[model samples]
Target: MYGLMSILVHSIMYTKFITPLGIDASLNRFFEARAIDHVQVLAHEIDGRQERRQGLKEAAEYIKAQLERLKERAGSNFRIEIEENAVGGSFNMMFLGHGISFGYRNHTNILVRIVNSYF
Candidate 1:
């Protein structure tokens, strides 16, 4: 798992344009410790399935916290913004033979957005 995470982080870093050269080093150090933590927190703690409204809210807060931490580390000029909006509810449905159907409604989603910033 560690190896996979390292590869994923490196791949992500490679895709972004590193500025000032020094930022690359800082980003490398930052992601080394935080990337896995972020993934675990989002994937495990933030359950987005049906009936998990609180979980969705918690996930949004978690993302905001992470962004704030990054902004603080990156310096005073860095800015982060978060927005929440209500989306139409969705239904999960499955149809079986003999005209049987099963479905459940899922609440709105919490959207997280990271503003323009240089890393």
Candidate 2:
């Protein structure tokens, strides 16, 4: 199973030129160990479905819980939007000169968006 690192909700803002604020910015100094714990949880608890294509919703729920926790710790004026939906798609690829085609069916997709009111 692959592990996950604890992520800051503001880190999402970095994608759009936003920086962490107050307690959120200071978290990396104190939450280094907590990040490792997150890794362990993702590697174990969430592995129940992550290794397969069937349990993404469970992982998404876990992520939502984490985000909620971070939201509480964030300074101010930051809003988080977490979106989940059932999505399906297909793709084709070449592997070792062999034709490979795959499809996503009944798959759950989760998207997170961070909105900074100050901006």
Candidate 3:
């Protein structure tokens, strides 16, 4: 048989989403986590890898910590902007001739923008 590790991350994504590219490098630079230093600092690495309660919390904490670390390493070379919003709502719909109702409370959305001043 083969062996398995506790490493939670399986993938990484990088892109400049809606940013004006005017941030510092210290605020965006990370030591792996995604750059490959063996740290799992992404939401997708949630324990159990589920979008449910505890797992979600784990993922959120990981992301928060990573961002905090980046902030601590601040410099004028690059910049990073972070925003968090809590959204809750309910919806009712009919599916396959059945009535279904769903409501979510304290759903949080985190957005981060890494800007490179040079470009």
Could you report the Cα RMSD, in angstroms, for every candidate shown?
A: 10.5, 13.3, 13.4
Residue-level lDDT tens digits of model 2 in 1-119: 12223255445655686343444536625554567678777777665563244456677677778877777766678887777787788899999999999876666676778888999
The order by descending lDDT is 2, 3, 1
lDDT of 3 by residue, 1-119 (tens): 12223232222234345533333334344432345422443434555643346776666666777777776676786788878787778899999999999888666777888887778
Global local distance difference test of model 1: 0.60
Runs of candidate 1 with Cα error greater than 4 angstroms are 1-32, 45-50, 76-79, 91-119
On lDDT, who's better, 1 or 2? 2
Global lDDT for candidate 2? 0.68
In model 3, the worst 10-residue window by lDDT is: 1-10
lDDT of candidate 1 over 32-90, digit per residue (tens): 44566688888987787345467866776777676666656654544655455655543
Per-model lDDT:
0.60, 0.68, 0.61
C-alpha positional error of residue 114 in candidate 1 after TM-score superposition, expressed in Å:
5.7
* Best model number under TM-score: 2
The candidate 2 region of ten consecutive residues with least summed lDDT is 1-10
Q: Which residue pairs come into collision in candidate 3?
A: 23-78, 23-79, 23-115, 24-77, 24-78, 24-79, 25-77, 25-78
